[model samples]
Target: MRALIVRHEHVTEPGLVGDRLAEHGYRLTTVTVVPEPRHHAPDVPFDFPDAADWDLIVSLGAPWSVYDHAAVGSWIDGELALLRKAHHLGVPVLGVCFGAQALTTALGGSVEAAPRPEIGWTEIETDLPALVPPGPWFQWHYDRCVLPPGAVELARNAVCTQAFRVGRSLGVQFHPEITTAMVRGWLGLGGAEQCVRHGVDPHALLAHSRAMEADARANTRLLVDGFLEQVANTTA
Candidate 1:
């Protein structure tokens, strides 16, 4: 199987998710939207690949919100079109954070600023243990997605929707793809400053991530397996 991974920025790579995809024999083709050296620049041009060639599409997290179309320029619209096309074709998609927001928008929902930004590790309530675990998922977002049309709400907490599923596509608000190295990169790249601005202690965030690395990786692996097995195509 082939999976197209849409990497929005330098920091948020596929991480453990890519590892699991490889384990499942899914070859990954990553399309880095804003490569290094120009990653922080706003309104950079984004070139997306044709989604039909891939068996699955995985959209990773990003610092930008889906509603920031003006700042993101035409790329946001292009991505939304891709999401819609993939869905219509019954091609499975898994979206995280900003990707989830994009999925929501593509499915006729909206994204907006949350009541409060979520940073660091947080728990989400879920009955779908086959897909999502109950505790300690990485989160770093100021936006929340409204449940899209025909979507099933799979998980939630006081702060956000957490996750939802529309047919074979899943949109998760939290980060299950974060590895220790990925977390460290995020913290080192002005993420600490953003946390401080949000009244979050960067030190504590790092400590929490360090403590949860083992459990997080295990949970992420399970989620990845579930996504590929239950959400993607199967030959009967």
Candidate 2:
């Protein structure tokens, strides 16, 4: 099997999810959507590959908001079109964070700025624990997905909706693919400043991530397995 990973930025990698996919004998083909110089968010022109070519599509997170069309409307428009096409073609999609918001928008839902941003590790309430596990999951988003019509909400919390499923697609607001290295990279790219503004201690967040590294890996593996067996294979 093959997985097409849609990385929104250079710093946002597949991390543990990619590792699990590789272990399951899936070849990864990564496409970086925005490859602009430096870590500054920019509106760059790019094209997604043919969605029919890959067995699965994994859309990674981004620093930008999905609702900010005026800023990233050009590429986000193409991304939404591609995601809709992929969904129509019955391709299984795993959308994380901004990708989840993109998926929701692509599937007749809406994305908006959250009342309160979730920055650190937080626990969620899950209706489908086997599919969407309860956390202590990593979160770093200012927006929230309102969920598409016909979508089954799998998880949520006081702040926002956490995870949902529509047809062959699954969207999770939290980052199960997070890793210490990825967090470090994000921190270097002004994430620390954002954390400070949000009243979050960057060092404490990093420490928590380091402590949960092993558990996070195991949980991510379980999530991948569940997605493959339940969401992907069932639809196939």
Candidate 3:
């Protein structure tokens, strides 16, 4: 099987999520929308590949908002179109954070700034514990997803909808693909200041992430297994 991984920025990588997908016998193909050079100005034109060609799609988190046209540029619309086409074609998508927001928007929902940004690890309330485990999942988003029409909300926390499903796609408001190195990279790129603004100690957060690496891997394994068995295999 083939999996198309959409990386929105230079820092974010598939990490454990990609590892699990590889374990599931998938050949992964990653496409970056905004490279390192274009981080500050991400409005560059990018041609998203056809989603129909892949067996599964995974859209990783980004530091930008889906509704921010001026910030994300015109490529957001093309990505939205790709997601819509994927949903209509029964292609399974796993959307994380910003990706989740994009999925919601593509499926007739809308994205909005959250009451407050959710940073660090948080355990959400899950309707389907087998698939969407209530976890201390890594989170770093300033926006939230309003459910798309007919989408089953899988999980949520006090702040926002954490996970949802439409067609054969699943969207999560947290980052299941995060790694310590990724967090470090984020910290290097103004994340420390962002954390300080949110009352989160960047150093402690990094240490905590390092400590929970094993647990994270275990949780990701379960998440991937359940998603493949229960969600992805389900027909549109």
Candidate 4:
């Protein structure tokens, strides 16, 4: 089986999700939507590969908002179109954070700026705990998904909707793919300033992420297993 990994920014990587996919006998192909030079502000025209060609698609997080059409509208428009096409073709998608917001918009939902940004680790309430585990999940988003019609919300928190399912696709607002290294990379790339703005210490966040590494990996594995057995197989 083949999995198409859509990375929105250079700093973001597949992390444990890719590891789990490989363990499940999936060959991964990554497509970086916004590469190095264009990382900060993506303005170039880009297109996604045919959704029918891949067995699965995993859309990674981004620093940009889905509603920022003025700055990133050019490529985000294409991404929304691609996500819609993938859904229509019954291609399974696992959208994380910004990717989830994009999926929501593509599926006839809406994205809006949250009253407050959710950063660091948080425990969420879930209707389907077996499929979507509660808490200690890493979150770093300033927006929320209103949920597409027919989408079943699996989990939520005081701040935002954490996870949802629509047909074969699953969207999660938290970063289940987070690692200490990834957090460090994000911090280096202006994330530190964002943390300061939110009154969070970047160093402390990194340390906490390091402490949660082992448990995070285990949780991610369970999530991937649940997704394959529950979501993907049922849709198939």
Candidate 5:
């Protein structure tokens, strides 16, 4: 099988998620939308590949909001089109954080600023724990996804809807692909300051990530298995 990973920026990589997919016998192809140099001016022109080419599509998180067209420009529209096409083609999609917001928008929902940003590791309220575990998943977003029509909400919290499913697509508002190295990269790129503003100690957050490395990996493996067996393979 083949999996197409959409990395919104240069820093965030397909960590544990990609590992799980690989273990399940998938060849991974990654595409980066915003290069490191274009970090500030993210409204760059880009092309998204055809969704029909890949067996599965995974869209990673971004620091930007899906509704902020002024920041993302036409690329947001293009990604939405790609996701919509993927859905129509019966292609399975795993959308994380900003990607979840994008999926929600593409499926007739909307994205908006959350009451407060969810930073650091947090647990959610899940209706489908076997698939969407009520985990202490990593979260770093200022926006939330409103459920699209015909979407089954899988999980939520006091802040926002954590996970939802529509057709063969699953959208999770948390980071299951997190790694210590990824956390360090985010911190190097002003993420530390963002955490500080939100009353989260960046240093402690890093420590927590390092300490829970094994547990996080195990949880991610379960999540990937559930996505494939219960959601993606159901249609296949």
Candidate 6:
């Protein structure tokens, strides 16, 4: 099978999700939205590839809001178009964080700023315990997604909708694909300010992340495996 990963920035790799896809014998191809020179910048080229070319699609997180086209450049439009096209084609999508917001937007839902940013380990209510871990997934987003049309919400917190599914597509508000090095890079790149702004202790975030490393990676693998299995069943 083939998987196309739409990577928004250099930091947001597919991580354990990619590893599990590889385990499932998926040929992974990444389409980096932002050019190397503008890796940190929100500006990304708007062009999109044919969704029909891939067996599965995984859209990674971004720092920008789905509605912030002015800041994100033309990529927002392209992403929305891609999501809609994928939906029509019944292509499975696994969207994370900003990517989740993108899925909601493409499916006639809305994205908005949460009352406050969620930054660190949090316990969310989930209906699918088999598919989602209960707590301590790395999180760093100020925005939240509305459940899209035909979507089944799987998890949530008092602040936002945490995870949802529509047909073969799944969207999660947390970063299941995060690694310790990825978290450190985010922290070193001034992400600490956001944590501080959100009343999250940087030390606590790091500590909790370290404590949850084994569980987090295992959960990532499970979710990826679940997603790929669903993809297989759909095409069977």
- Total backbone collisions for each predicted model: 0, 0, 0, 0, 0, 0
TM-score of 6: 0.93
lDDT of 5: 0.92
* Model 4 ranges off by over 4 Å: 234-236
The number of the candidate with the highest lDDT is: 5
By how many angstroms RMSD does model 2 differ from the true structure? 1.4
Between candidates 1 and 2, name the one with more favorable TM-score: 2
Each candidate: RMSD = 1.5, 1.4, 1.5, 1.4, 1.2, 1.8
Candidate 1: Cα lDDT at 43: 75
The residue-by-residue lDDT of candidate 3 on 1-236, one tens digit each, is: 88999999998899999999998788999999998998999999999999889899999999888999999989999999999999999999999998989999999999988999988989999998889888889999999998989999989989999999898899999988989999999999999999999999999999999998998888888788888888888322
Prediction 4 global C-alpha lDDT: 0.90
Better of 1 and 4 by TM-score: 4
> Per-residue lDDT of 1-236 in model 5, one digit per residue for the tens?
88999999999999999999988889999999999999988999999999999899999999898988899889999899999999999999999999889899998999988999998899999988899888889988899988899999999999999999999889999999999999999999999999888899999999999998998998899899999989897432
Candidate 6 on 70-128: residue-level lDDT in tens?
A: 78988788888998898889888889999899999999999988998888878789887
Window of ten residues with lowest summed lDDT in model 6: 227-236
Q: State TM-scores per candidate.
A: 0.95, 0.96, 0.98, 0.97, 0.98, 0.93
How do these models rank on lDDT, best leading?
5, 3, 4, 2, 1, 6
Q: Model 1, which residues run further than 4 Å from truth?
A: 233-236
Provide the overall lDDT of each model, using Cα atoms, as 2-decimal numbers. Answer: 0.86, 0.89, 0.91, 0.90, 0.92, 0.83
Clashing pairs in 6: none
> What lDDT is reached at residue 137 by model 2?
90
lDDT of 3 at 186: 98
